[model samples]
Target: MKINEFIQKYRTVTKLVPGLTSSHTPHVICNDGFEMSVQAGQSLYSEPRDVADSYEEAEVGFPSAEESLLTPYAEDEENLCG
Candidate 1:
């Protein structure tokens, strides 16, 4: 799924299970109550070798090193007005 679509879906699912926070990177609350992060290009059967898939696709449209890091600068601030 696209990044925007993934964010929307994740927002809805997280409500049922609290302690879930997904900002720039997608994450989910695991069955054991721990958190799991979903990297780009990940599917239901994601593997360690899948890292490059998203990077390749993204390059065709907007080639940049930005996507290499998930969280943007603004999102790094823990306090809004600090």
Candidate 2:
């Protein structure tokens, strides 16, 4: 789907980065959950289409479950020393 169409469908923020050879593909950041990068060769005026397995991917690599569970407690201990 096109960039604008994707924006309309998802109603998210889209960013376009200009590259030396060509403008980079548009990427959308969703308000509710995740970020999506529009497929290459797609244009803003093309037909609206859903990206395959689009919602399954995550842009940022988050900490593992164990790390995440302990991070807050570790921070709290450091804060208490101040």
Candidate 3:
């Protein structure tokens, strides 16, 4: 997936080290929920890993880092709501 697509899903892209991030190449999000921009190469290719289980974005809903981080607790969320 492209970086834009990845941003659409995982909104908050937590950088490992902003200072180390480079401008060249494409940036992608890994399955582990981290955005790789620094020293990213063609080998990394272009596939944005989807991290959210059932997380959905509303028409105007802007997902926050905290909200996206809570995706792991999605199962527990259903239990609570159920």
Candidate 4:
């Protein structure tokens, strides 16, 4: 979704929280407990989409726990000998 559209939809519902520094961006906590920062003089987009993209990237880059456990390493023999 476009940044303007996202801001328009949530602007009314979001409340501004105290910023840590002079240039610190304003943050809003959504009804669902999601928090996001709004950049000054710029449109802000949906954070959920960004989070989803990160998860998708992680899923592709990392192996499953079961697969990792099934794999053997040369270090295993070295550790056993010690």
TM-score for all predictions?
0.22, 0.23, 0.19, 0.21
- Please rank every candidate by TM-score, starting with the best: 2, 1, 4, 3
Candidate 3: minimum summed lDDT over ten consecutive residues — where?
55-64
Q: Can you list the residue pairs that collide in candidate 1?
A: none
CA-lDDT, candidates in order: 0.34, 0.36, 0.35, 0.31
lDDT by residue (tens digit), candidate 2, 1-82: 5444663465433344542122234455545444434432234322323222233222222222223433453435443222
lDDT of 3 by residue, 1-82 (tens): 6444544454543434643321232344457675434222222222222222222331111122234444564545443222
lDDT of 3: 0.35
* Model 1 agreement with the true structure over 19-56: per-residue lDDT tens digits: 43223344644345544344443232223223332332
* Candidate 2 clashes between residue pairs 3 or more apart in a chain or in different chains: none
TM-score of candidate 2 against the unseen true structure: 0.23
Displacement of residue 1 (Cα, Å) in model 1 is: 14
**How high is the lDDT of residue 53 in model 3?**
26
Q: Model 4 clash tally? A: 0
Candidates 3 and 4 compared: the better one by TM-score is 4
Off by over 4 Å in 1: 1-8, 11-23, 41-82
